[model samples]
Target chain A: MVRWEPGAQERLAAAALELYASRGFEQTTAADVAQSVGLTERTFFRYFADKREVLFAGQDHFQQLFVANVAAAPPEASAMEAVSFALDAAAVFFPDERRPHSRLRQSIIDANPGLHERELLKLARLTEGMAAALRDRGVPEPQATLAAHTGVTVFGVAFRLWVGEHEERPLGAIEADVLRDLQALSPSVR
Target chain B: MVRWEPGAQERLAAAALELYASRGFEQTTAADVAQSVGLTERTFFRYFADKREVLFAGQDHFQQLFVANVAAAPPEASAMEAVSFALDAAAVFFPDERRPHSRLRQSIIDANPGLHERELLKLARLTEGMAAALRDRGVPEPQATLAAHTGVTVFGVAFRLWVGEHEERPLGAIEADVLRDLQALSPSVR
Candidate 1:
């Protein structure tokens, strides 16, 4: 049995990303990732099902943060307002320090059709999770799902902008900008 | 050599769906689907890449119809209006006749994680295609993407309602209702 070690998962993830960037996702193996971090393959399997899971490790955390924030929003908040609060709260999970890693991870995913599909699936799950949270908060059908999906769309747009090489603004600010732009899509709002 | 046959694709798709539903997706094969339709396995490959493609055959058609309709909308129409027009136009692709097939297909897809991921990817492609068409119409940044995604979301919700076991309303009407609900999601609109 492999002994438990502190920061092992993070170490593995960082090594996996580096190898994926240099060797390409398709050419990289689980053993290569484990070896890079000086860990056994068994330990790597204990942390991730495979190499792809290393890149997607944060998706569950993102969903949890988004759902918890939406569920905790004040009862008086509108669906959009609640979504906004949740998005802002979730932004804290993605700090500037992680932006470079995100960019590299995105490039790796973009190059691989399989990884891209998994990314889309992850985003879809996040939207569904947020929608369920909205329903729990008493939002009605269709509206809750729509608001949750729109919030996710805004988050996606904001994330792309926020991760740009020159982008210096906080993610919450970028999210606010994208949310305003989304709202402006409504003729009445314009 | 397999001769070109009229409705060969449709025949294969129908056979594939029925087989998938009755025998479970994983238990079925290309040979089984082709044989069920009295066609050779070679003919099946001429139509679909694999068994999974049978259930997703409509995705390309859906994307073409949506993009063409959005592009053909009146120049004076707002982005949202154009999206509404496109969605309405696309509804024609799913008449009452196809509802049973669609419902059956959805159940098979829902039971399989791999198929569900492919479905999400297909929807993402549809959204991207519509967004590109909107941009072609000079809909401007962010708004174009947002409107396209919202249109796809409305399509999804309307589709679920339209395919319900007891749903009797036409797909177009359900789409209009869902679009209205989505619009009302904006604080200014409500």
Candidate 2:
């Protein structure tokens, strides 16, 4: 049902990342990105609205994957549990070979204020999608919203750890540690 | 002691909000703000870095207030509990009279990408500050980070509820609901 072809978007994204990392995001041109993929500028436009869109081309698919996973979670799962399952589903989208490239994209986003805002908006949308999925699964209002917020916050922390070199743990291991961290944060204490 | 003079900051903030609401944030000049308060532009600058700073001016004080409260919590409280207590302290800072102004400020920030980016950075910093506070309170590495992240996410959800409601309830009630939502998130159900 998606209008954009997967390979075309992926090629454009990979090409954009190379151009952005090499020339800096501010210095990289649409023509440079198009030329890197041996595609015309008009063809690039067919995939993305502009240069910034190329950097975030796969976000829609990620949202779809997340929502679908949440929707398909076991019926007995709590709202938060369903969110955790959705996060695990999203992990398959990130591969080891692409980690460094994604890290570079995150770095460029961090450096650019406009991109950071867009990133925040993207995160907000993801949380909204998760909440909608939870609602569809019979979860109540505020709980659905809270679970979605918690899930995204967990993802944010996990991704930051993934990008940082802390004993070179695999991304899956780091994500598991993040989930454990959330579990260990109980209100009861000595 | 807090650094900024309270009354002066309050007047300038009120004037700026009024100008921003009526004339628009960009169209409203520093001179207009100063004139509204029957003060000089120099005095306005003394209170705020610029027109934009008027909207963000209280954030640092909020950080200080939150961290200090966390430090002051019972040493035996769990990391999340301590952070929750600190959030409660910060809740007192959100006076009933200020809700309208807070909503207006959010609208302005939402409409401007530059302001929204700064807002996200501020939220990130607050998360970091809460994490540091937890570490100081003897919480361990990753749990400290999770505690901070959860605290901020709870704050985020609570804020959205607080601002979205046209007829406002006490912030204490909203904070209680946010904490309950966090507690109701049972992980064992998955």
Candidate 3:
């Protein structure tokens, strides 16, 4: 029987990020990450489909958190308001203590085209999932799509700022700031 | 001497889209596209790096057009205004007559995971290019990124609506409508 490891995924991910930084992503293997954490290559595979998944595995939790929060929003909340509620939920997924790790992870992703594309693909899926949740709330057509996309975009821009080496603000606060910037850009906002 | 075939690219694309729909994107080959267009396989290679390029070769032109329009917007134009002006320019690339072609192309893309990822990557690059152009106009940080992303999202939502079989509106008009929807979602709009 295989021994179940608690926190195995987080351990493997942190080890993988360290290796991916010291060695290039292409140079690192699942075995390396596994051995770094005193586990076998099979254990790594148990948590992630591949090395790429180590960086992206959080996508599922993020999608679920956003959708759940959107669904849980007040029935009368505006589309953007529902999305804002979701962003606050998403902030818990990236607490203040993880900023350094987030920065490293982002730099690694920015250096690799394949990883970058995977990130964009994940973000697109998140937007679609969030929109579907909003539609379930009866937010119609392009409004659902636009608000979902804007929420994701605001989260993205804010996350980028929050992860900057010199920036110490919390992610949720940055999201609120970016949301206002989005509002200001629209000359016709009510 | 390879005689330059005027409109060879267009002829090949239409033929490829038809074949991709009829025979399926996977079952089709580059040589098949060339033969359907009455050109040599070598000619197809000259025009595209691979069969996939047949669908994406226009991305370069799309990027240039968007960047050019963004740069050309009046100095007083807001970030989204610059992007909206660019969207009008983009509309010319997808006129009323091309709706059927676009719908077919999208169905093909939606059916394939790899092609969909490539499409997302291209949209991401387009957003980055637009943001850079906005930065050149002295736009800063998250606002430029937010506006650029919003513009692309608006274009994407509007394009999907414009290509619907029941929808007969012009692409530019749908774009304007989607933009308004985006503005209205921002409850704090200026």
In order, what lDDT does every prediction score? 0.86, 0.79, 0.86
> Where in model 2 is the C-alpha error above 4 Å?
A1-9, A39-46, A72-77, A95-97, A107-118, A136-138, A163-174, A188-190, B1-9, B22-31, B39-50, B71-77, B95-121, B135-140, B162-169
Best by TM-score: 3
Give me the runs in candidate 1 sitting further than 4 Å from their true place.
Answer: A187-190, B187-190
Instruction: Write candidate 2's Cα lDDT for B1-190 as tens digits.
Output: 2345458768888888888878888788998998887777888888788888888887778878988888899989888779878878867988788788788888888777778767877776788888999999888877887888778877777777787758478676787777776776755422
Over A1-190, each residue of candidate 3 has an lDDT whose tens digit, in order, gives 6889999999999999999988989899999999998999999998899999998877677778878999999999889889888888878889999888889999889889889888888888888898999999999998998888888898888888998889988998788788788877874321
**TM-score of candidate 3 to 2 decimals:** 0.94
DockQ per model, Cα: 0.51, 0.38, 0.59
Compared with the real two-chain complex, what DockQ does model 3 have?
Answer: 0.59
**Candidate 1, residues B88-135: lDDT per residue as tens digits?**
786788999989988999899999999988888889888889999999
Q: Write the per-residue lDDT of candidate 3 for residues B1-190, one digit (tens) a residue.
A: 8889998888888888899989989999989998997998888888888888888877678778978999999999888778878888988988988788788888888888888888888888888898999999999988888888977897789888987879999988888888878777764421
Clashing pairs in 3: A189-B189
Tens-digit lDDT string for candidate 2 (A1-190):
2354457767888889887877788998888888887777777888789999877767777778878999989999878778878888767777677678768888888888888767877877787788889999999877888888778877777777777654366566667777777876754321
TM-score, every prediction: 0.92, 0.77, 0.94
Question: In candidate 3 chain A, what residue range of length 10 has the lowest lDDT sum?
Answer: A181-190
Q: Give candidate 1's TM-score.
A: 0.92
